[model samples]
Target: MTIRLVLAGCGNMGYAMLSGWLKSGKLAPSAVLVVEPNAELRDRAVALGCGSAADAGAIPADAVPDLVVIAVKPQVIRDVTAAYKRFGDGRTTFVSIAAGTPSATFEDILGNRAPVVRCMPNTPAAIGKGMMVVFSNPLVSADAKRFVADLLSASGEVATIDDEGLMDAVTAVSGSGPAYIFHFIEALTVAAEKAGLPAATARLLAMQTVYGAASLAAESREDPAMLRKQVTSPNGTTAAALGVLMGDDRLTNLLTQAVEAARLRSIELGK
Candidate 1:
């Protein structure tokens, strides 16, 4: 369906989603209106051929978008969303990407009848390879949920959760998963340097190895454990490495703990 979208912010995440929508033909430039306080950011949206304004109040009074995306930071979301309250008259669906903010918050501000969607998107969304997870309030129609999913698919894969409480777990995993991978790369690079490789070569080896392994894992028909078995030979170098990382399920346990910690923190922040 053709959707008229109102984007409430034009920051990195906002611009990334906007770019994806336009590039994927999900939404046309003429159908979007971006409201950003930052001149530079607003200009960036304007450059994409979307309508732009310094504030929501500047938007035409008659404008009633099909979707109003609240992409501003959580701290200022209340004030920013208040300006667009007129659009929340049961017609426009509100989608928020702000972490820790719940659909209940929007329901409180925009009235109980307004359909709302809460999404958790990671940094990789900027590169179009992200994992976008969404939860919608019951007021949202099935068609609106599909439209939201279609818009998000432009960024990457999209998943839907029936329980809103699980969002904290989703945030801990996909939302913060990239940082864990990045740290692993750093550690691998340092280990390579200690093993006598030149710094530049070590960095390249570490990066490419991770990238290749991940790509292989993603594309391979076999599961990761089976794939690992395929590469390992008895008493070989790969076996020795696996002996350390897999001993007593050390790595698995460590990652589980890390995800739990992040999930707890997410719950705390939500409060």
Candidate 2:
């Protein structure tokens, strides 16, 4: 509760992470200072008992937080981060969740003295079921890396990568992975409806099946391939379905192409 963190945006993602941290007791409300330009968003942060400000300049001069989280849009990141260069003396670590913005952007703005961590988080993070991957620059202390990982875990699973280049792959796999799943749900729902299920039931079956299967896959010790085989019988109904979906690795190849397309787009955007 010592104002150890500065949250530069209080929009949906920022609010979700903040609420998760507070709910899990990973951070106390008094430990955060939220700088949200929008009055409504700032009010939401204030409602949670944290200090709220309209901008970085409004933050108290005496407040030197351990972390400064940038959740603003990537386009405005440079302008937004320029105001906090005073904290770039290697004491405060900068963490960014802006899509397509690299850690180097912060280092460029804050200078070599600043430590930066770039995170790729999926939309599911809003529901505490996200995949959060981070890549930190060399200047980030060992303890700071662990602390950032722990804080991110409040929202969901956390992973770290040594190679920043792999972040493009991360962007494809987890960052954009939710949309893939959502599309699958949409396809499945339509398939169900075509197969004679009511619209509501089709939607329910599609969503619940995906949700339950994902939960099982997550909890089971067996790998996904093994789990897939467990429910498939020789020339049975599941096998019949698998024949259409997995014949000649059709689904696998299709997904590979999709992921590659996304990875390439991510690389292009980063530049």
Scored by TM-score, the top model is: 2
Instruction: Give RMSD to native, each candidate.
Output: 1.5, 1.0
- Tens-place lDDT per residue, model 2, 1-271, is 5779999999999999999888889888999999998999999999999999998998888878999999988888999999899999999999999988888889999999999999988888888999999999999999999889999998999999999999999998999999999999999999999999999999999999999999999999999999999999998999999999999999999999999999999888878
Q: Considering summed lDDT, which 10 consecutive residues are worst modelled in model 1? A: 1-10
lDDT of each: 0.92, 0.93
| Best of the candidates, lDDT | 2
Off-target runs (Cα >4 Å) in candidate 1 are 1-3
TM-score of 1: 0.97
lDDT of 1 by residue, 7-101 (tens): 99999999999999999998889999998999999999999999989988887777778899999898888899888788777888999999888
**Structural similarity to truth (TM-score) of each candidate:** 0.97, 0.98
> Model 2 — TM-score against the truth?
0.98
lDDT of 1 at 14: 96
